[model samples]
Target: MANTVSAKKMTRKIAKRTAVNRSRRSRMRTFIRKVEEAIASGNPNEAVAALRAAEPEIMRAAQKGIVHKNTASRKVSRLAQRVKALVA
Candidate 1:
């Protein structure tokens, strides 16, 4: 229970932020899934295009604190590697 006025306001703010973050996180995952699907389908062009779209979304999620910076970079690296392998 938030008794203080400031605490109550903070709680409300937190709830709003939580909803926004959840939406952003879900969107980021959707982009990642798209990239994975493109990769799994084994079309180099599609995979490359999907990666191009997803990379920025993943990085944005990290920037917004939804994921760690290192985790974002690692994910991008692995996905890029897979895409490269598919191309080769």
Candidate 2:
């Protein structure tokens, strides 16, 4: 449907970028899920460690433009709070 050469190139590029972003987002979710699982199991030490590990991955996804900065910050804040509660 793209008659222009540039448009065709852009479509191809977008498809590639979409695949990459999808994978990045999926990986980020996996990290978050690990932390959540640790928290749900109620092990403060493991939860804390999982949160620490997940934090950077989430931030990195934001930095790479795969996710919004506020979204990443909110997730980290909530996870940290939950971990802290587990400690208390």
Candidate 3:
């Protein structure tokens, strides 16, 4: 449906970007899930490690525009809190 050459190129670029964003989002979710699973398993050490690993991935996703900044911050904060509680 894109008659103009520019439009066709734009469509291609959008498709590429969408795939990259989807991959990034999926990877981020996987890291978050790892942290949640560790937490649920009640292993303070493993939860701490997973949270440490997930924090940077979440922040990177936010930096890359795949996720909102506040959402990333909130997730990191809550995960850290939960990890701390596990240690207590």
- Scanning candidate 2 in windows of ten residues, the lowest lDDT window is 44-53
Q: Poorest 10 consecutive residues of model 1 by lDDT?
A: 27-36
- Give the alpha carbon lDDT tens digit for every residue of 1-88 in model 1: 9999999999999999999999999999999999899989989999999999999999999999999999999999999999999999
Q: Rank the candidates by lDDT, best first.
A: 1, 3, 2
lDDT by residue (tens digit), candidate 2, 1-88: 8999999999999999999999999999999999999989999999999998999999999999998999999999999999999989
Name the candidate that leads on TM-score: 3
How close to the true structure is residue 85 of candidate 1, measured as C-alpha lDDT?
96
Q: What TM-score should be assigned to candidate 2?
A: 0.94
Q: List the global CA lDDT of all models.
A: 0.96, 0.95, 0.96
RMSD of 3: 0.7
